[model samples]
Target: MAHLELTGLCKAYGAICIADRMSLSVPEAQVLGIIGPNGAGKSSLFNMISGDVQPDAGTISISGRDTTGLPSRRLAKLGVGRTYQIPRPFGGMTVFENLLVAARFAGGLGASDARKKCGEVLEATELSHLTDETAGGLRLLDRKRLELSRALVTDPELLLLDEIAGGLTDAECISLVAFIGELNKAGITILWIEHVLHALIEVAHRVIAVNAGQILADGSAEDVMASKDVREIYLGSAEALA
Candidate 1:
């Protein structure tokens, strides 16, 4: 059975239909990428899955257990960890402290366990050198790394990443892509929403494209990019932006 399933997912706010009965399934430990133009309900989809927003209609299941409409805290405890498009580290805290807090609050880890987990996550994310740096002092790339570290501290089975590579340079993006690929190879299911087409193509086995609240294409990276609807909606126009 698929590890995560979104069946007939729909959401609306007043007259705006943000997700129109979108459905998809992701098997265990696979990497799925989401691509679309701006305002394509990409972030909204993450919000729904992470339980920040409840759908008007649909069923969300993780490991075959229904999680639709569950609170974000509940979902996190269920091993669904997510990162936002914009990194939101605690400015007053040290890098290590920020991850320690995430581990304690989101993963419900004990003091010693949280500290050890935070250390591991920082090392994995290559932030060990900046452990004592103030979160407010981090540059863009380090901030992004910190975001991923925070998510990883929870030891999630499923990771949801939103634009983690958006502001990175080519070299940094390649490094981040390699890091994510390594994570996937280690058996973590990943659902990534990114505007960086090349990066997605590098890491995702399958790509899903959403437009105006509906899925327009889904298949292998090459196949989805080659789809008529995807080309017409965003792929063809994306070169200038990419």
Candidate 2:
């Protein structure tokens, strides 16, 4: 069964449609990348899958079970996890504390288990040295890592990543790509929305291009990026197709 599936999803606010009968299915353990222009409803799609936004129409299924309209907290317990484009850690809390909260709440771990999960997540994200540091004090790279850690602490079956590589240096992006690759290797099914084409290309097994609330292309990463429609809508110029 597909790890995640969306059928005929439709959403709109006023006259602006964010998702127009969109549908997709992602097989287990696959890394799928989504790309589009600004205001293309990429994040809106993620919101719906993560249960932050209810679709006006359609069904969402995880592991072949209906999960439409479920709340974010409920979705988390069902093994759905996500990271925002902008990292939203508790600024006043220590790194370990923030991870512990996700482990306990989202992961539904008991106190002792939550502590063990936090330690594992911290080590996995290479944030062990900063475990006692305030989340607000970390630099951009560390904050991004924390965002990933928080999502991973939930031990999700399907992970949604929204532009987690947006503001990193090339070296940092490479590091993150490596980490993400490792996560996928560990059997986490990932659906990533990223404007960093190279990073997405490195990790995603397949790619889909969305625009104006509909999918324009879906195929292998190279094929989708090379598609004329994707180039025109997302890259904005034929020069990128060259």
Candidate 3:
């Protein structure tokens, strides 16, 4: 059975539709990449799956159990974890404190267990050096790492990442790509929505392109980028095709 599945998902705001009858599935340990233009419903799709917003119509299942419209906290317990396009770490809290909250609330761990998990996550995300730093004072890269660390504290089976590589320098993006590759190797299933095509292509086993709330292409990363429709959509942005 698929690790994560979305069937006939539909959402709209007034007359503007987002996620119009969309369906997708990701197998266990597989990395699926999602790409689209701005406002093409990429983030909205993540929102629905993570239960930040309810779809008007759809069935979402994780590990074959139906989980449509479940609240975020409940979904977190069910092994769903995600990072937003914009990192939202608690400003005044220390990095360790921020991760501890996720472990306690999202992972439902006891104090000791939460501390253990937070430490492990910090090590995994390479943020141990910043443990005592205030989250709000972190640099962009550290903040992004904290976002990833927080989600991982939940020990999710299905991890959703939204543009985790955005705004990084090329070298930093390369480092992040390697880090994400390591995460996938560690057995976390990933569903990534990113405009950084090269980074996504490097880590994803397959890729899908969304346009106007619908899938325009789905296949191997190379093939999807080479698709006539995808090329047309990214016409002038040659980097997206590269």
Best by TM-score: 2
Q: What is the clash tally of candidate 3? A: 0
* Top lDDT hit: 2
Cα lDDT of model 3 by residue, 1-242, tens digit:
99988999999999999889999988999999999888989999999989999999989999999999799889999989999888898999999999999999989999999999999889878899999999999988788899999999998888999998989899989888998888889899999999888889988999999988999999999999888888878664557656
Q: Per-residue CA lDDT of candidate 2, range 141-239, in tens?
A: 788889889999999989999998998899988988998898899999999999999999998999999999999999999999888998888766788
Q: For each predicted model, how many residue pairs clash, with residues at least 3 apart or on different chains?
A: 0, 0, 0
Model 3, residue pairs in steric clash: none
Model 2 misplaced stretches (Cα beyond 4 Å) = 237-242
C-alpha local distance difference test of each model: 0.92, 0.93, 0.91
Q: Candidate 1 — which residues are off by over 4 angstroms?
A: 235-242
Q: What TM-score would each prediction reach against the true structure?
A: 0.94, 0.95, 0.94
- Residue 169's C-alpha lDDT in candidate 2? 90
Ranking by lDDT: 2, 1, 3
Residue 134 in candidate 3, Cα distance off native in Å: 1.7
lDDT of 1 by residue, 1-242 (tens): 99899999999888888899999999999999999989899999999999999999999999999999899999998999999888888989999999998899888999999999999888888999999999999998899889899999988899999999988889989899999999999899999999888999999989999998999998999999888788778845656545
Runs with alpha carbons beyond 4 Å of true place in candidate 3: 236-242
